[model samples]
Each structure stands twice: as C-alpha cells, then as structure tokens.
Target: MPKLHALELVPDEAGQELVRRDWQALRDAGLPSQLDHRSPTNAPHVTVVSAPELPEAAVDVARTRLGSLLPVRARASGVLLLGGDRVTIARALDLDDDVVRRALAVRVQVPDRQHVGWLPHVTLARRVDRSSVQLALDVLGHRDEVLTLTELRRWDPDLGAVTWLAGH
Candidate 1:
C-alpha cells in the first residue's frame, strides 16, 4: 500500500538529545535500529494524525490554521508499555486535546483512523521481548523533559521523507 500523509511533532534540542541518549542506551543493550536517524522511521517524532492519503491543499490549509501552536511544551515519561507481550515499548508524550481535535477535523479525507482518545507517544522499541524491555527500563529510568516543538512535520511513510512546515 502507498503511504499516506502523517502529521507529526518534530522535537527540539531537549527532545532530540533525549532520543540520542535513548538510542545509545538501546545500542549498548544490543538492540536493533538504534542511532539510525538516517532512516525516517527511526527518527524521533510523535505522530499527530495519519491518513491513507491527503491533499496538498489540506496540508497547506492546516499549516495556516495550526501554525501558531508551534513550540509546544512536549512532555514525556520514561517508560510506558503500550501493548501485551512482544508489544511496543514507548515513552509517553502528550499533545493538547484541542489541537488534536483540529487535526482530526480534517481527517474526513482519510477514514479508518480513530482520532479521539488518542495516546500520543514516541516508540522506543516495537515488538520487543520482555528482557529487552527491562534493559530499556534499566538504562532509561523515569525522567521528565520539556520538548519545544517548533514546527509540525509532514511525513511520507513509503518514501521515508519529511517536510517541515514553517512556524514562529
């Protein structure tokens, strides 16, 4: 299937540093895809909305309407287990509920996505074993950091590309 347009939060200094730190921890623990920012999928981000496909016009409109919300204070906790055994291990992040609403208001173009009650997070590892999860917890303990989200990003999953939308 062709990739859809996905909107995401691009983190600032603190967040990026956190990602780098986390990546190193994972690498030290002999995990896969660590410090692999060269791959878009491995890049640090928190996706806001994803659709099968999106129009260029809608993206531009969203840029204009949601531009001011940039530089959001993104907060994340240390370790969060998102699924059952061999599930996704992630760090929890939160975007404002209202902002999420506006993003979904445009989701009519793309269906099969549940925008409400969304739990925003940055996946540290996916389908990891129990031992790996413990290693991650041991490496990265419970911590809090503020991520200054200066811009929203448009991600193309199939192409592994990201387009940054300007914000002030």
Candidate 2:
C-alpha cells in the first residue's frame, strides 16, 4: 500500500511536556487521544506540508529533496478547528526563510497548503463533542510554545513505518 509523505519534527523538552499534558487532559475530559499518543507508532510533529495523491516517483523525489532544506523551528499560535468538534490546540511555528524557500522547492502537486499558508500544529485532541469545545480549550488554555524542528521523516501512515530524511 502507498503512504502519504509528511515531515516529522523532533520536539524539544518543553514541547514534549505540553503534548503530554494535553493528551492526558483530553482523555480526562472524555475524549479520545490522537495518533501520536502511542509513542511507538508516531512522534509529535507539525505537518510541515501534506500533499495527497502523488505518484511513487514524486514521493521518491520528496524523500530526496526534503533534506536540502535545513531544519526549521515551527512555532504554534492558537487553536485550529478542523470542522465539527475535531480541534487541535497548538504551539506556533515561524516558518524560517530557509524553510519557506525549500518548502516551495519540495512542494508537490497537492492543491492545498503545500504551496502556501502551511499551518504547523501539534494536535491536542481529535473528534470530541461540539459541546465539549470549551472543555478542550480550557484544558489547553492559551499556551505559547516553540518546537524546534530538526529532520523531516517520511512515514508510511498505514504501516506506521518511518525513514529519517537525513542524508541525501
């Protein structure tokens, strides 16, 4: 099976703590955790860019070019509502100049934010009640956080297999 291409960010200590707290709070507040809660499966990462429906060749190209761009620090600002009650409380990401230029270079033919306006976020919870929005917000509060991104890791979402985009 084919897998989507994503950039995995290695979170700093503070970022890690924030995610941990958020995960626990969401569970306590009667919501299920997102995928990353299983440490063995996924790491906490801001989706630098995601493009759907690409050929195998493009993915191979992405894997090659991702390392060309130096690692960037992605900061989180506020909460993003992914329709219904699916919400992600986030720390902000300041897409650096090096990151910007290379993100474009590495951009595939996906008709979305892969080209512009990439929203970087750490998901707090997913698929909770609309009535529980405030509860989720209350748990997250107004947290200003900074996550330093190092390398982009290509992952097989279906199989939960990952390869580090380190050396070209």
Candidate 3:
C-alpha cells in the first residue's frame, strides 16, 4: 500500500511547549470538541512538501537538500477559514529558498494550486465550528509568537506515523 507522506518543519522544544499550552487553553475555553489524534510528540508542524509515496532515493535527496540549511523564523498572525465548516487560526512562516527547493524536489501530485505555489503555514486547529473559530480568533488576535523550524520529518505510511529524518 502506498503511504501518505509529507516533509514538514518540526517545531523546537519551546515552540512545542507553547503549542501544547495553547491547545489546552483552546480546549478548556469551550472550543468545540475537535478530535486531534496528534500529540506533543507529534506536536504541530508546517509541511514543506508531501507525496503519496516516493522511492528510497527521494529520502536521501531530501536529507541532502535539508542537511546544510539553517533554521528560519516563522510567525502566526491570522485566522483562515477553510471552507465554511472547517476553520483554523494559522501562523505564517517565512519560507527560505532551500525549504522551497527541498519541497519541490519531492514528487507529489498535489491538485491544490496553492500548495504548489510554495505557501508555508502551520494549522492551529481544524474541524472548528464558526463560533469556536471566532472564539479562537478573538483569543489570539494579533498575538505574535516566534517559532523555529528544527527538524524535517517524513510521514511513514507503513507505520502510519511521522518519523524524524534529518535536522538542520
């Protein structure tokens, strides 16, 4: 079976901690119960690239491309409504050339033109009702947080998990 895999920017320790606290706060503040199977171990990450499946060589290619790159600064600033029912507040991160090049190197048949356009973002929540989304937005309005991209991870299909491949 082909695995669904993605190359994502994993958050550093401080960022992960902040995300955990924020998620807990969001849940505690009566945001609608949206099921998130991900954990602090998984935390939150911005996808650099994704593919249905790639050859083992692609992993090497990704590693090689990512090995020498330095970390970039990213920030979360606005709320995005994906479709009517799905909503998320996201942080926008600056995309470096190396990140884009590495993402493009991975072959993925993404139909979303936006995805192909090198827009990098990390989602804070999904499956959120309008009221909950609005509440989140109100809570997080104009808040700025700095996050560091610490590692590159691949979503392994066989294991149905994300694994650390390389760090820069």
Candidate 4:
C-alpha cells in the first residue's frame, strides 16, 4: 500500500518547551482531560500539507527541497474548530521560497473533492468533545502565540512509523 505523507512545520526545542508548559497548565486546570490517556511528550505541531499517498521518489524530492530551506517564524493567529473530534490552533507561516515552491509542486487528490486547500494548523487535542474544547479555549484565553517552524516529517503507513527528515 502507498504510504501516507505530510509536510509539517515542527517546533524547536524552546518552542516545544513553551507548548509543553501550556499543555501542563491546561491539564492542571482540567481543560484537557482527553490528554490524560496520551503521553506528555507528544508536543504540538502544525502541518503544511498532507497526502494520502506519495510516489516512491517523493521523499527524495522532499529532502532535496527541504535541506537548504531556512527555518521561518510561524505565529499562531486563532483557534479553529476542525471537526467534532478535534480542535486546531492555527498559525500563519513565514514560508521560505523553496518551501512554498515545493509545497505547490505536490498535488493531493482527495476522493469526491475537486481540490482541498492547504490549511496550516497545529492540533491541541484529539478525540475532544465540544464541551472540552470550549473549556480549553476558556483556559487558553488568548488565541495567538508565536512559534518557529523547525522541521519536516515523513510518515509511513504500512510500517506505521514516522521519520524526521529535516531539522533546523
């Protein structure tokens, strides 16, 4: 089977620390009860593009395109409701030239859809209900924060593994 792949904007160590602290505060306040079942090490991150499957050469292409691209500042803008099960914290990315060009080159075809726009967002919690999400928003108070895009990741579905291909 073809693997699922995504181009994501990962946080740096310092950024991750900030996110961890925020998560802890939320957890302590009982805003993220759903997180209790998951590991705390699963920090926050934003995805640029996701594809159901990629060509075998996609990784190589991604690596080449990403290697020289410098890291950029991504500022969180607001909170968004992704689905009933998930809530997204959105960020505005200062994408590098190569990053933008490379992302535009990749095409994703979702069934029954003509095209889906690429929306950049970092997830706060999964399997969350509306009440829980409302609690989280109330706790977070403000919808904005600044984070850095530090890495790109590749995920293999068949192997059920994720690999970090680039880091700044």
Candidate 5:
C-alpha cells in the first residue's frame, strides 16, 4: 500500500491525554500500540480525508471549508478491530452528519472516507498481532469518551510532518 496524505481532526489537550493514556495502557500490557509508531508527528487524530496524493490546492480548500467547522463534538463510541489478519485496533467516533458531508465535499477518492460508508475512528494500534488481539481488547475495553475536536491538520507521511490548518 502506498503512503497517503490526510486531513485529520485533532483533539484538544484533555482529549489527547485520554488517547495517550490508552496508548500507555496498551504499551504497559506489552501489546502493539500507537506508541510504537515512533514518529514525532504520530498523534491521535480522526482522519476526515486521505488520498495517495493531495495537492496544495486541495489542502487550502480543506483548510477553508473544514476548518470553519472547528470544535466539533466527537464521541468516542468504542474500541473496534479493523482489517483482516494484522488487525487495526481503533476507537470509533460518532461525528455529526455535516462533518461527514463536508468531508466528502473535499472530493478525495479515498473510499475509507467516503460518505456512503465511512467509519470514522482514531486508531490506537496499527497491525496488532493476532495473538495479541484478545489481550489488547482485554487491556482496552469498551471505553467511551466525549471529545472536542479542536484542530484541523494535514499529515504528510512522506515528509513525516504535519501542517496545522486551523483551530486553537
């Protein structure tokens, strides 16, 4: 799979700590977690749009349109296991319809962020081992949280960098 650029919704300080605590818990349990990603740019975020290539124009448009809808109330629904063999454990999010609508308006061809069937989530662990799935689940139960997504940022994995688009 090719690397992708993404527009992500960043949580406030308190919300971030909530996620970090989860990461730490998984780490303490000797399970795969976002903490293992090892990049300074690696942080908790709900991806709104992603594509193999995102142009500067597209980024600017997202900054203007999506940025205007700052401070969205996002509910961390629960823990979800995505993918087949190497599962991705994530915290599902329940966002407003308008947020989903504007995300599709970005016109990105990424299926994961499509309006028809988009499962918004903030990933906790990537490619967790099958043997650790049950353990990870046990470690991180169905914990729910109400988080305020306060910032919009663009993630360029190629550069290992993030460009803050909006919010305090």
Candidate 6:
C-alpha cells in the first residue's frame, strides 16, 4: 500500500483551538469525533489535495505555488455532513472567497474521487450515525467564525510528520 500525503492549509492557533473545542464537545457527548485521533500529526486543517504518493519535491513545488496566498481570511460558516453511507461532521469553510479558492487551486491532481473537488472543511468527526446528526449539531452550534489561514503543510502519514511549507 502506498503512503498517503496530504497538502493542506492550516489556520492560526485561535482557529485550531476552536476546532479542538468542537471535537472535545462531540467526544464529551459520546459521539464520533476527531478527538479519537490522538496522533501528533492530527489537527484541524483544510485539505487542499491528497494522494497516495507524491514526489519528494512536492513540498518545494507547493511552496512556490501557494506561498503568496497565505494569511487568507476565510469563514467557517456552519456545520456540514458529508459522505453517503458513513457521514462525516465538519466545519464548512467558505469557498466563495477568491483568495481561499485560488490558494486551494494549487492542488496536485489525483485520481481519487474525494480529491475531485474541494469543499474546504475542517473535519470534526467521521462515521457519525444518522440518529446522532441532530445531537452533533446541538453539541456544536452554528459557527459563523472567521479563520485566518496562515500556513501550508504536508502531512505524510507514512512518516507521521507535518512539514511546514509556507507562511509563519
């Protein structure tokens, strides 16, 4: 099996912490949540692109491609439920922002279905049951929050490392 490498945009501390709080809320409510993933590499982020395998030079290429688009101000509009069989609860990021869309457009094309288009979300939970949708929503109320995207990162699952690419 090939290692999965994801190119993503990460928000500042405030934004990350807010997502963390949401995860904690869901977990405390005994619901499926990202808090279950205790890996050091796991955190709140918007995936720009993902592939089973990417060249070693991908970092540099991404940096050059998306460097100037940093510090993008985006909105975490509200809660989102994605997927067909198993639902995923997430905080929806605003794609209407041209800067956010342009930055995400630097994604490397991959053949995976999930990578076909970007919805720009910070996942809160996965495999949430239909019965628990309302409960999850209640736990995490409407979030009309702004997030300042400050960095681009490469999350290499094989190496379990998050390498900083651009921004402070």
Return the top candidate by lDDT. 5
Ranking of candidates on lDDT, top first: 5, 6, 1, 3, 2, 4
lDDT of 3 by residue, 1-168 (tens): 344566677778887766666666667776632225444345678776666655666667666776446465566554455647566556666665666777676534343223445667776666777767767866556566777777877776666777778773
- TM-score to native of every candidate shown: 0.79, 0.72, 0.77, 0.71, 0.89, 0.88
TM-score of 2: 0.72
lDDT agreement with native, every candidate: 0.68, 0.60, 0.63, 0.58, 0.84, 0.80
Q: How many clashes show up per model?
A: 0, 8, 1, 0, 0, 0
* Candidate 1 residue-wise lDDT, 66-118, digit = tens: 55567677678556776676766678876677666655554544454435445
Candidate 6 lDDT by residue in tens digits, 21-116: 999999999999998998877878988777886555555656776666677777899888988777999998885466555544455434442356
Q: How far does residue 106 in candidate 6 sit from its true spot (Å)?
A: 2.1
Q: Lowest-lDDT window of 10 residues in candidate 1? A: 108-117
- In candidate 3, which residue pairs clash? 76-91
Q: Write the per-residue lDDT of candidate 5 for residues 1-168, one digit (tens) a residue.
A: 778888888999999999999999999998888999888888899887777778676777778778999989899988888878899999998889998877666655454442345578889998898888989988988878988899999888899889899995
Candidate 1 backbone clash number = 0
List where candidate 3 sits over 4 angstroms from the true fold: 1-3, 32-35, 38-41, 107-114
Off by over 4 Å in 2: 1-5, 35-39, 51-70, 85-89, 109-117
lDDT of 1 at 114: 37
Give the better candidate number (2 or 3) by lDDT: 3
